[model samples]
Target: MEAYLAWVAIDLVIPNPMNPRRDHSIESEQMQEILRSKGWAEAITCYRKGQYYIILSGHRRWHAAKKMNEKEVPVYIVQAPENNAEELDRLGSIQGGQVDWTPYEWAKYTYDIWKNSGKASYSQLANKLGISQSLVGSRIRVYKFYPRIEIEDKLSNGMYSLSMLDYILKWIKRVEKHHFELYQSMGEELIRKQMLKKYENRCFNSKIAIDNIFVTSACSKDILEFLTDINKKLQDCQFELELLKVDNEVDVTQNKLNVKMIIDEIRLIECRTKNEAGNLKEELNKLLKEIELKENQLFDMVEN
Candidate 1:
């Protein structure tokens, strides 16, 4: 079949069942807003199939059009893919840059392709998909482990994250190793559920905070060192900013002095003249105490 563009009735185009995307509510609503304001600009990509056309991409746009009671919409009709794998590849390639696939969504399509292609090698599949083999393996693992609809929905909805999944896997390994007694007592399924619940409740709104808390819970010394490095860099930036305010020429001559030597001199002067050093010391002390408390509490939670 020859590929061509045409205007089709809104109802004639159907969403692909094999498309990895499960949730379109958010994207569709955003597109609906765009349509109302600027009107439709991009054509839906689809392929001829029987009396109706199956969408290859632009499922969200089609949804948005229907929601707004659009009568007809522009569509680019392409030749039907020879196989499911080809169709999935086309969809992934087309949508790759526009929007990221959710962790589970990516897993779903990757698993489907692997399965449908007679269980192809991870290396071959990864090469074809332009991703690492380890990534392909991990996605397949995620798909298998979280096959339950409810769990997949939570991951798709962004209630949890891909990093959280990695954390959960690490926690499981630790439970199986150092915490063997707890693992035996709780069993695998319950341990998984409990960990999910624990992280879900503790998950923060910000990625940085989530990483901080997770890292702190796992190893406080690392997070403390990370914070210390960040603080030192912040102080350096502040010093540079102050110098820029006083005279731009200070920047030109900054390389002449050892930056560390300059910072130490400034710190010594500030320590002599200001109470800010005392406050920072107190804050660091408080943070240390809080971290110790959290470590103890986390250990207790894991054991109980």
Candidate 2:
């Protein structure tokens, strides 16, 4: 096959109107807008054996160029091979290097080509694409199960990484028996609530453990009772202190009266015999005698 650039009017016919590659919606619209704005309506494709095949590397650009009604789009021609197998192999190689086609896209496209051409194996396709057989298998699996609209949106938005797509496909398949919206909403809500509850419980447990270590430990049932008792005692002590502060002179007077009242009460409650009371009286008399002696000595010095 020869590969060379050629103009649009090179005796080529647009073949296979039902070509799978021609189904462009998201990328095509963007391409058309861009070309209309920039006036760069030229695009590239592959031509072979009197048939023009559009290999959508830049599918949007091709669509835009077509929309502009441009008579001729630039292309690279590959001469037809001897057999269908060689032709498909050539097409797969060309598609393998094409841009805008993701791994999933390439996987689907390659699978279709091989299935149609009846010549390519999964291993061969994986080798040609420089991907693992398992990965190729996974891509094929996802292509079979994934929602087309979701996959297309993700692919266009650059959010469709292989791992994420794999996860989404697995999640969808697991919940396939359920209603789509119900399953989606339930999954999302469950994830959100689960994460939220996990963090909240962690924070609460950490706080409780810390408080037990550094502050005080109490059961939830006993905490209110303990706090109430402590608060009451504190309030009573505060009230007494406030009264004392408000009248310092009255506080002193009241303390003296309290001392006298305590002495009178002790005397009234005496249960000692007359002999014991006499012994106490004699001790008081001795103390008074000592005080008198000291006073007399002090007076004599002053007089002299």
Candidate 3:
């Protein structure tokens, strides 16, 4: 349908809300503040084909205008579909030209609309709102995992970040599916301790590698801290492993030494060990060969 803009009088009895999209809490507060601070009122637009439909801008403003019991608010009327499906699809694409929302805000907004519409693609929804598809997907995933109470509290308090929500969702999923039994059996304290222990070990290993590569003024301090933390973790893991160890008599000292040597060789940059380094060495060699093949193909193309 051809789109045209027109102003419509504010009606209290107008049953259809401006947008079906909820999480309007943020928008409502923002619009109200803007209007009160500016000491001005503005026109809201509605799309009309047969019955009047609000479109484009002033969703929050329209609500505020209603609350204030204002008469004949100016509106830019545009032509839009009257049917539910078409109207929603159009809403998904339509830019209200309102203030730019943050990633979290946009995620929540887009997620609701997408959930309701069940027709908008991730790319289409994100593109319409000028956000990344991954972000849209991540938000939807977060919404799926997080309890409504937590999300509402976070969003309301403005303590929410998309990254934080992403992490929380991941943690929730991990706790729910993989660790639920363990979490229940071991209790929250023990689970937390194990998580912290694992994190410390990984951090220690990463830091050791980094320190070996780079030299800096604070390097000593970092290394000392990392070593201290990692040593504690190592002690814990060692104790745990010792508890689980089985009493078996096998002469494997030579084999253990060989494996350690192979691990050392993998850490080296220049050395290439094919036979001596075992499966890890073989995997590395294969990866290097694949990289070389790709490089050769690129070189040939350039030469041509």
Task: Tell me the TM-score of model 2.
Answer: 0.41
lDDT of each: 0.70, 0.52, 0.54
Model 3 lDDT on a 0 to 1 scale: 0.54
Best by lDDT: 1
lDDT tens readout by residue for model 3, 175-206: 54544554465564444344334443443232
Clashes of each: 0, 0, 8
Runs in model 2 deviating more than 4 A are 1-6, 10-43, 49-61, 81-88, 113-122, 158-161, 164-304
lDDT of 2 by residue, 126-214 (tens): 78667887777667666665556546555656645555455434433333333344446556445333322333233222222122211
The digit string of per-residue lDDT tens for model 1 on 170-269 reads 5465546654655676577765665566566553223332332233232333322322342233233334455555675666367447656755764665
